[model samples]
Target: MGERYEYVPHRLLRRRVRDIASGVEGELMAVISENVSGVGAEHWVELAYVRGPSGREFTTSVGNIESAPGGEAG
Candidate 1:
């Protein structure tokens, strides 16, 4: 994994992040891990829960998040 991916989980919590594909920006509320089985093995994926400005909530993959424009977490 690249350095950016490694730091994503640590830096994302309570911070404003944007969903890369959907262009949805919000404050990240939590990160959840889920296990999956594939190819004779198991792996975990990170899921991020975010709340948007209008109080809308959604979940997206951690891989889809990036720091929101403007600044750090308020």
Candidate 2:
């Protein structure tokens, strides 16, 4: 497959950014740059689905990362 997705959120770990999504959690292989904003902010992102429960198939999204945007999401 020639298609590739970027890990805007995960890559920002340098900015002290760590995100967790539903049905998925923990470290991922690597985060790449899908789209970078002129404002130095990430609009869209793709995660490698580092950790997940056994027998569970789920995809990661920026929405999940935005929900908390850091941690302790209500």
Candidate 3:
């Protein structure tokens, strides 16, 4: 049998996220880039590109997002 997959809403990519480990709370930033379905149907995965306060770029999965405030779609 083939693996089942579901479509992720584009609105999810627009939401901002912050790293709880950074120790600074209540801060959010938009994802500059993403591959919504890089893993394909077999393994559903969503990746987002974000820039930290330090000006460092990193990738984080949608599931990892601590918070998602609905905003403009990227």
Candidate 4:
């Protein structure tokens, strides 16, 4: 038997996610929200999705919808 500590893949991809929702609650700041209750006349949403291109396409949440104070969302 042998132990494996090394591994190789064809490609490597990494992402980082951060939520500043609580910090900008009702403050005209950018938010990542998703309607978990479904789309309707009375629907609520939660802060989900990351910041980047093709939003909500990755494991991240809250992006491209708004800017970070003095910066723009990329």
lDDT of 3 at 35: 27
Q: Judged by lDDT against the true structure, how good is candidate 4?
A: 0.31
TM-scores, all models, native as reference: 0.69, 0.28, 0.38, 0.19
lDDT, candidate 4, 24-63, per-residue tens: 3111222333434434454434333333443433222333
Per-residue lDDT, model 3, residue 18, is: 54
Top candidate on TM-score is 1
Candidate 3 vs candidate 4, lDDT winner:
3
Candidate 1: regions farther than 4 A off: 1-9, 36-43
- Candidate 1 residue lDDT tens string, 1-74: 21222223557688889988789899998877766545655576778888988898898888898999763836
Please, what is the whole-model Cα lDDT of each candidate in the order they appear?
Answer: 0.76, 0.40, 0.45, 0.31
- Pairs in steric clash, model 4: 49-60, 49-61, 49-62, 50-60, 50-61, 50-62
Residue 29, model 1: lDDT of 88
* Per-residue accuracy of model 2 over 1-74 as CA lDDT, tens digit each: 22344444453232222245353444343445455344654554554433333533334554454222443322
Better of 1 and 4 by lDDT: 1
Superposed Cα RMSD, model 2: 9.3
> In candidate 4, which residue ranges exceed 4 Å CA deviation?
1-30, 34-41, 51-74
